[model samples]
Target: MAVLVGVGMLVAARPPVDVLGSFGSLLQTFLPWSGVGVLVLLALAALRRSAVTAVAVLVPAVVWCSLFGGMLVDKRGAGAAGGDLTVVSHNVHDGNPDPAGTARSLTASGAQVIALEELSPRTAPAYERALAESHPYHSVQGTVGLWSTYPLRDVRPLAIMPWTRALRATADTPKGPLAVYTAHLASVRVSLAKGFNTARRNEAAVALAAAVRAEPLDRVVVVGDFNGTTDDSALAPVTAGLRSAQEEAGAGFGFSWPASFPVTRIDQILVKGVTAVSAWTLPRTASDHLPVAATLRW
Candidate 1:
């Protein structure tokens, strides 16, 4: 049992989709306490004179914590001292009835740049109109859009799929050109035969990563409902080079899904060639997912 748990914990520390990612989100609320639990279990086994069990449990506990302990720290650092940008990302569930209210709440967040996904044709116009007053410069392609206070240029739809799957726009900020990507990767649904159906999501991630890599801009921000965690191996193509704003500056795990009772952070704000001073999840609104905001500096 100790060996099994040890192996499981090791595997879990690796990435999402493994037995660990599949369950870690559920256990993260008590991650620090879970560490204590592992220690206690090891102690009990030793007290019971089970040396092998004790070692097995103790060894894995130490390894797992050492590997991901930084993630448990509440950095909450100031946005890059010279940071010049504020960005927000959210998946405004296409079927949401309170599109106007949702738009109001997002605009109130005071985000200088906003990237949204899962936009429906019916609601897109409303969101565009609502955001226009604040973000005068914006671009939309397919179901994704980027609203910015800075001038937008080189707007293009990322061919993440043979069909459109993401949007990319370059914001000519005073500092320089910042490439912004808004993508709603294919959602993964679980099944007995497929376990976690991630083929489509993986494909989209690869395509987006390739597009970002090929862009001419030095500063890039990618945001939206990735439908998978940064820990997921399928997102390695993107995660490998970019930094998650929440992980860099957030006060906690920053979960943002199932807004009523968020358990995982599928929404993300990833950046490269810029500093993330702070990152946080916004209050719940009419949508099923909470918005994620980040403050950054060049």
Candidate 2:
């Protein structure tokens, strides 16, 4: 049984079938959590006190470490001392109970660039009022918005969904012009009947990726609630050419959803041609999702 478990993990490393409602993507979403299996195997090996079981346990342990061990070490500080820009992304739940307090909490981070998703007309006013002092330049297209301390230009809405759920803008920072994309991709679901449903989110990801590819700006920053992790194959279209801020310079997984007890990272700060100095998740606000913040050099 121990050997079989290790073998199963090795098989999982390769891409699995996705025809059955994106089963492969679903597994990939929580692939990091598979390490827990190794712990169970170790306990079993200890109880049996068999050399064979001990050797079998080593298989999955090595595989899990090889897959995510690097993330355990601290890779920050390269750009930590002096970063050219700071950005934060959050899915401030539409049904949040305290919009004013949430906005205040976000502003306290002092991120120069902030992108928010799931914003409704009623709650947006509170954000606008609270951010007016620090992030003077702001743009909102439908449910998504961008607030920045620098001047903004060529602000436009993206057609990734039926209604407005994404936007793009050019931030005129001291470094240069940066194409900033704020998006809230269609949410996915999991059910026994349909398995993992990601068709809508996959289509939106393709559209978003196309926009990023055609962007003329040399520096680009994509911040939002992706609804899928970078590991999920369904999001490859959008993550193919981009670098995740957390993977580049963060201490751990940096999960940002379910503010009470986050298990996976859905909100992301992905960049192209911008150096990520540090990436971290902020304390919970009134929103269901915790905010993700990153500092960039250039």
Candidate 3:
């Protein structure tokens, strides 16, 4: 059991999947609580007067907590006085039964810029119409879209697929041109032979990273359901230059998936050359993933 838990921890820390990207996000949803389980086992062993078992349990508990405790800190700091923009991101589950409700909830978030992924053909029009009133400038490509309060310029599609995959839009904000990229990377599904497959996700990540690296804009924001975690090796190429808004400003772990019982934050907002003042996970809605909001100062 100890060895199994240790292995699980390692897998949770670094998802072990191929072709798809769901494993890491799945593991992150459950791994943080494993330490508590270890502690419980240690207590039970101690109660049974099994000294050896107790020691084994205690050691792993301490080690695990020591390794990841800092991540539990309320990283979201108080909002700065001069934040230039506020952004929100969500997957909005393609099969969401309540598009109007989701739109209402998002509208209440008061985000100046909204990035959405998993936008199905049937629901995209509803979202576009719903947000049209406040976000006059908007752009969509494939399943990804960006709605901005400011004027959008040079809107284009990102190369995440053999065809159009993601969307990129530049907002002409008062501070400067803010380049926004929205993507719903390849979804990972379980298979018989492989525990997790992330090939397509890895390919998309590489392509996205290359595009971002070649971007001419000084300020950039990337948002969407990455289907991977900040710690996942597959995401290293993108995380190398950008800072996670939740990691910088959120309090505690910002889990945003499986809305009914969120365990991982595959939905993310990453920024470059901007200060994240505050970040937080919003309340549950009709979608499978919860929304994430962040304030940024230039």
Candidate 4:
């Protein structure tokens, strides 16, 4: 039993051959938790006094550790001195009770570049008013917006979804020009009706990935609520050339969803042609998501 389960764990990373693999991908999003399952097996093995089962348990345990062990060590990300440039990404739940308060929390982070998503017409004004004081140069393409201390140009919306949930622009930083994109990919759902309803998110990722691949700038930063984890195959297109800030510089898993208890890191900050010196998650705000920040250098 141990050897069979161990082999299963090893083969899990392979793209799903069928529906089971699709479902496995969903479970893999929280793959670290699988260690707990192995623990349960170990307990049963001890109670049964089955030495074979105990030996089997080690297989899955070792396999699980190999896949997710690095994240267990929270290496210090950035430092107090900070990086040359700071950026933040957030999905300020449109249903949030206090849009102004959320905006204040974001500005408090001292991010020179900010990307915001899920803005309705009514709440948009409050965020604009609250952020206007600190961020003088800003642009709104569809529901997404970018606010920066430096000048911005070549701003436009990225039609990854039916609505304008993604946008791109050029941030003319003192160091140089940085192409930036803020995106909210289509939400995914799993239910009895559908095992893994990822078609929409997959389609959006394809379009966004094409845009990112076509980007001409050397330094590019893409940040927002991806509605998919870095492990997700659907996001492979967008993630192919870039790297996630959290994986490169975060202290730990850096999950940033369901502010009450973050399990999956759907929110992200990815970069190319630059380094993420530090990446970390902020305290929970009035919204459902915890804000995410990253410091970058080329």
The TM-scores, one per candidate, come to: 0.85, 0.96, 0.87, 0.93
Q: Which candidate number would show the highest TM-score if scored against the true structure?
A: 2
The weakest ten consecutive residues by lDDT in model 1 span 25-34
Q: Residue 152 CA error for candidate 4 (Å)?
A: 1.3
In order of TM-score, best first, we have 2, 4, 3, 1
Higher TM-score: candidate 1 or 4? 4
Best by lDDT: 2
* Model 4 C-alpha lDDT per residue in residues 189-292, reported as the tens digit of each score: 88997877777887898999999999999999999998878877657899889998888888788999889999889999999988888888988888888989
Q: What is the Cα-based lDDT of residue 280 in candidate 2?
A: 89
**Global CA lDDT of candidate 1, please?**
0.80
List runs of model 3 lying over 4 Å from the truth.
1-30, 49-58, 80-82
lDDT of each: 0.80, 0.88, 0.82, 0.84
How many clashing pairs per prediction, in order? 4, 0, 14, 0
Clashing pairs in 4: none
What is every candidate's alpha-carbon RMSD to the true fold? 4.0, 1.5, 3.0, 1.9
Task: Flag clash pairs in model 1.
Answer: 16-231, 79-277, 80-277, 83-297
Q: After superposition, how far is residue 193 of candidate 4 from its true place, in Å?
A: 2.3
